[model samples]
Target chain A: MSSEDLETPKEKGSTGEKQASEAPKPVLSSGSFLLVDYTIRIKETGELVDTTSEKEAREAGIYDASKLYKPRLAIIGKGMLLKAIEDELVTMSVGESKTFEISPEKAFGQRDPTKVKVYPIRKFKDVEAPLVVGARVNINGKEGIIRSIGSGRVQVDFNPYLAGKTLVCNVTIKKIITDDKEKVQQILHNRLPDVDIQKFTIELAPPEVVITLPEEAYLLPNLQIAKRLIAKEIQENIQGIERVKVIELYTKQT
Target chain B: MSSEDLETPKEKGSTGEKQASEAPKPVLSSGSFLLVDYTIRIKETGELVDTTSEKEAREAGIYDASKLYKPRLAIIGKGMLLKAIEDELVTMSVGESKTFEISPEKAFGQRDPTKVKVYPIRKFKDVEAPLVVGARVNINGKEGIIRSIGSGRVQVDFNPYLAGKTLVCNVTIKKIITDDKEKVQQILHNRLPDVDIQKFTIELAPPEVVITLPEEAYLLPNLQIAKRLIAKEIQENIQGIERVKVIELYTKQT
Candidate 1:
């Protein structure tokens, strides 16, 4: 394989035709960092479940300003994605596209009749959301959907929101991260999913991986545990990294 | 002046006689980190109020296991020491001991009879401590001392505890830290009073002072603000500290 074939997807423009006809796909494996674009939908009602494509998300009325719109990072066999998608990813290659259907059993699980329960309206006094049908609520730690609210009573379904429904998922692998440092950072970023990975400035120096965390993450719950876990994971997954030095800079503005 | 005079209090064994008779005490000034031993008592009753010495605390039946029985840190002109004591510290030299009395007006302020109020015993149900006389309680954010509890009524005195009494304060300056980095650290330590400053591993590197925080401090409230303040204080107080880098390590046990 030529080095040109190994170039990042952005730089290797219009390689699609050559990739489809001439080039052989690389055998992707566990811990591989794949930048993938995916669009999920409910096959029965053709409703958009989720999408990495900004256009599709905007069209489906699920566009969020806070969300990253580019190709999503999916680490193979690391559970950065659904088990079903990860399983398919291990068999596929870079630049490959696949469409699959996940049954209810493999998704959020089939809905159970026993999961539904009814409680008096007074029981929801502490709930901040209005007592209306279809509003989600958590009563005594059990997450439920308010199925009906009438006769001074509320019926809640404890089943997961997507239970009993099959989902159609279309995915395209855009690029595979090859650099060792970038790969390690993506894993740490996955652990701190809320913060952008780019903000976690990481530098590799043979035995030490020095990472300076963003100031905002200084107060994150279990941040210490997360840092240790990030270090441990990097040492275990990436070769030659004996130490992971995590620096938290408290700027003037905090 | 002997170099031995600059040694830590732990190493200055039996220098009391020599210090008293021979050595002209070095002048002290503001922002000096002094390790001071102190004992406070109610002048009228001779009741032990507080003491730094373990022997005195044990004798007074106020020994606490969680407390570090050592000379307390008193940063001159800093609020870490009481304003009255700080006012005295600037004039007092090292290795000197003094006993002084502060009146109610200079202490917690004179007792106000109007500050006392009578309330029904039911008002104290939410108070965890028993509503006994002399018990301290805080209601609706206002701290008050329970003066009497009888006949279905409770008399609460909202005046300061030390009000209407004079306190006898005895203090001895044990040692004064003179190292620039140590001085900055003591200042930071004063801000984070709950945790020992020793755990905050600090290394001075010319323009940069790198501090490694203990993992336990990761989840502290307003930790980000605290860190920023620490860095800002160090830079502003210590010369040549152009940068302050803080590191937090999370171990396997988290």
Candidate 2:
């Protein structure tokens, strides 16, 4: 093959997709940072499990002002989103919306018989909660529900609430991020929930990005760990990125 | 003053008790680090609120296997212990034990009438807990208790449980810490719960202490914050300490 053919392949697949027809479809990979909106439900009972849309949550009688209702940016294969959904997105292109059904095994795993155990009713003495069936109870920090109660015995199923249920999810990939700065910011936002990501200044130095934290962020607890996680996120997700230098400036109080 | 008198002043009450009779009584200072075991009781009801002794906790019917029953190491001015008790400790010596009663103002504060609010019974629709009087309920992350129930209205008191109650605390200073290594370790234990403090090794180099973390501790979440807090604790409590270097060595798995 001529040099033109080799050059064409690089140019066509490269980030600057000048030739739209020749460019490959933007397929999601393991560490792809994606902005997505999704709604998850129990396939059998049509019960809503979770949703990113505020309108859907209000209609389903599960709206909470504390919860953020917006398109979530998540790294595909890091268990930020469900593994089954992540697997399905690997073959899909950007802006693709699909309704898919996930089996119990693929979703939360099948219910195990060993997880259901009967214990003396006195075990829940500290738990002032009612022992009614289907009511969730926290036993030794592990949350479960009282499945049955009789003869001073309470049957508690430690299995996850959705363990045996099939999940039906309607997921839309709003955008597949290619910009390194946005990816870093997304990762920073995910790690440091309280700090405003937009306030921090990021400067590109080719293989490294210097993140200068704002004055307000200097006194934040666990800031060093946040910086470390940000560095790790940049190293793993962004291509050709090697180093992340975080500068925290502390101005003396007057 | 002569050089001998100036030298004598430093040795008078600074870590040594040689001139105990000549000098003033050795009183606890604000920054003093002490190993203490304390028992707190409600003065009005004579009900035990807390204790460091396992026997005391068991007798009070409030013992938990999860709680660490030991003399806690605390800095006097930091409010690690009760502020009222801390004030009493300022007058105490190294090995002194004192039983004192603290007023409601000095203890958990007086009960405010404004904190008692009447809400509609429908406000408890989300709460699965029993609507009985004195039932603790968490509303918007602040824990409160139901006080009364009338026609369509339920009264909830958001005041702290100990509010309006005077506290009688029996406090004993077991030992005053002088060694910087033990001081650092004690601070580490206080900061990082569950992790074995013995695993961390501290090497003192005047104005700096290097803390070597074990292999298992390298992966512990938010270790940077723990290290930062350790440094701050050492600097504030221990004399001549400035810097704390935390080294995490990762060994190659063969």
Candidate 3:
């Protein structure tokens, strides 16, 4: 379905279609940015999963007023947005705000029953009370939260993302970020510090580009095989790169 | 922190120790059941994350009268419970309900920054307006629900399970199923039909029984992979099975 068709009951406007059509095609320049404030409600149940207030932003370390107040920015052609929502953003201009609904296919996928399982009651040594059904517990040594508790059986369901759930997220476009590969990389690296981008060196070999990484990265247990994996990722993600070479170098750091 | 010290402001009664000492431990046996209905809340924020409402239980396909009204159940050992909470359940008896506080370490554990990342705005095509700071957005196919948006930058942090926040869960001991392994598996599989118990064959290797799966199970795609993963999980979870043999049987059709 079209993006406009996904609006919630509260999102309807008299001239929404006209305004969207007449609105200037936002120019996503190199440094232009926008800031917006919005809340999220589940489309099916309208339950609020979460929302951010100005107070929360300040507490979260966002100090810059300009960036914090009107911080919605957009970048076109660059994958700087959610494909589902970005499709909507491209249809609006500055100062335009709209609430949209996304299906489970677009948001978080549907819940997977396979991801849920029953465990022996003994695993809950730390609990002092009796076990019951519908009790939510924490999975030991894993990034999972239990959804239910049963008889001599304890059911632990991994996050569908861990098990793969098609989620439907209703969101508002507050603003968009600009398109700056370096800035984006810095943001990504800053957010994911465990990922050693320094290990991978990128070089422009004209039409064909080559990337190299330290062999130690591969040897590191649980490391996400970056060089080859990233090479394939970059190729699939970016156009004009004819080929990518992943070279592994032996390092004596260990 | 001690359980008493961990009690947040919302805790209803005296600390867990005080309540445990006052209530007589109900004599629980096979068939002796308890019914409890409670809500799990975040102690610090007093936010309700999960609840065992009759409405929700009915919606989840649990139609038994006991499950609908007062589901009396027993608490077994570890695998059936969270180590921290299960440790607490052992001290309680039937018909008793308590609201206890669990530290983040015991609840959801510490938040890992490695899971956070900031992606380019271009990835969100349907989003028209700029991303606002603190607006929730989906990131890299994960529900980050946006934390912050900035120039050429969208700072999307993920920690849905609030890190370091104390959790308050109200538990009622309903009926505890028998501790028999086969019986437990039947209950779990019955509750969650997607879990394949047959795929996971139990091997009677004394003191260290093993559970094996057919080789074809692994070759199945994402959904099937998820199913097999759940099956293999049964082996690692069974209480008495110290050693598990995950054999890949080529003859079996998964």
Candidate 4:
């Protein structure tokens, strides 16, 4: 697709069209952090599968609940995870926690049957197994781990998870790192490159931090928050800066 | 909880404990933006309800195919949306797209009678008349927008979806933004705090970016990849910097 075709309308303020006066961006100077804790459950069964409560996780582990192996964590705006999660994380302040249920429509998604394929047992030449029904096996040449074993069909579903399971994740915003804007941007980009730092800005306010992007970078979808997250990190690490403001200077289109 | 009680064995690198030297830590830095064009047909009747084609959506819109309003967008790591979508998003990369079909069990999930509640029409005093059977109506305070209006009793089910329905979503990876270290920590804390920027280190290797945290921050889950993302982002914006590193000189007990 041509670059022009990819450009969508910029996200306007919630009221639409009316530009909200830019408020004084709170600088998250050094020593600002967000602490968050959460639990994840199956939306259908309401069964707890994951949690940030290490103590509860340990307790569940004692009961042999392998679900407690890890708890979900993320830094707001860093793009280390999902935009929705980061959006929620950035909205929270210290010591504040909330639980929201995500639908299968919104959470993971409806399971796809095409993802479930029946492979022959010979595919597992190296894999040793009792190979009984309901047994889990590994696919030697596939992206997913085996979920179930069936009749001679050897149903080796490629999806990492059983289709149609709704997942609930409880997240706690533990701390927000506001310093090192440039570094935070590097983290989000996954590589250090030659770009103008002046092109970025971070504004920390309630609910989320706003990162303005240069016209050249605007085509990157969901990148607005990614920039804001980096700025938030710098504001958090630097002293006296309540928030990081990334101002993307207009650059000639490449 | 006592400080000692809070101290727990770090699960980092546990997945490959046997191959420690070559084993990359499970940084969990998976994130992707996907745009999928797909169609959903009932498993039993083969009736198409949802599709990526706008023409199809408009046609299906005429029916009670509430399933096709929004295209599925899954953000993996953060778990902000649905678990199934998140799982799929995590494993994908940018510029990649796929179409798949999900079973009812893996999509909306099996219908639960317990979730379906019957209420009285008096409860909906504000509702307009002509509440015929099969007509949708709102229920007491929940604002379901109505599923079906029944005799004497209103079968105002709370589920916003038609249970046991199969859905298809065509997903495209728009972009993948990895969380930076400082931001990841802030997300954990829920607020941004000013801190010594030198404390955290960022590494950009395969699987994800790694953030080496001080002992005080060691207990922070998913710290490694968060740092890597930050480092990668820094590398992108700064000149002559291939990678960003975080080093801690002192430690404090939280």
Instruction: Give the Cα lDDT of each candidate.
Output: 0.78, 0.77, 0.47, 0.48
For A59-162, candidate 1 gives per-residue lDDT tens digits of 98999987877678886777778888877776666677899999898888989999999999999999987788889898998889999988999999999889
Deviation from native of the Cα of residue A79 in model 4, angstroms: 2.4
- A-chain TM-score per prediction? 0.75, 0.82, 0.45, 0.48
Question: TM-score of each candidate?
Answer: 0.76, 0.49, 0.29, 0.29
Chain A (candidate 4) TM-score to true chain A: 0.48
Per-residue lDDT over B1-254 for candidate 4, one digit per residue giving the tens place of the 0 to 100 score: 23342222233335455456574433224443233334556656666655546676667563434333333333344454546655655555444566666766777787776767777767767786456654555554554434566565776565646477766655654433333443333332321122344554555442333444444643333444444444444444323444333432221112
- What's the residue-level lDDT of B13 in candidate 2? 39
Candidate 2, CAPRI quality class derived from DockQ: incorrect
Residues A1-254, candidate 2: write the lDDT tens digits.
Answer: 23232211122254554545574653567787887789999998999999999999999999998677767887887888888888877666666789999999998999998999898988988887887998899988888888999999999999999999999999977766777788888777777766776887887775777776665765576766666667777777787677676654322222
lDDT of 2 by residue, B5-100 (tens): 211111233544554557565546788777888999999888999999999999999998978888888798988987888888777765568999
How high is the DockQ of candidate 4? 0.01
Model 1 complex DockQ against the native = 0.40
RMSD of each: 6.4, 13.5, 30.9, 32.1
lDDT of 3 by residue, A1-254 (tens): 24453322222244556557764334533333333345444555554443345554465454445333323333344455446666665565444667776566665666677777767878888864445544455565553455566566677766543223232333344444432233333332322335464654566553445544443433443223332344443444344544554333221111
Residues B1-254 of candidate 3 have per-residue lDDT tens digits of 13342212222345667557755443442222223355666787776665557665456554356332333223344244445555555556544567788888887778778766777766666754457765666654556646666566566668765676788877865434333445334433433344465654554543344434433333333422343343344344444543333332212111
Docking class of 4: incorrect
Candidate 2 wrongly placed segments (more than 4 Å): A1-254, B1-24
Model 2: lDDT of residue A58: 98
Flag regions of model 1 displaced more than 4 Å.
A1-23, A53-70, A91-97, A112-140, A146-157, A184-200, A214-222, A249-254, B1-25, B55-65, B90-95, B112-140, B146-155, B184-201, B213-226, B249-254
lDDT winner: 1
Query: Candidate 3: TM-score?
Result: 0.29
Docking class of 3: incorrect
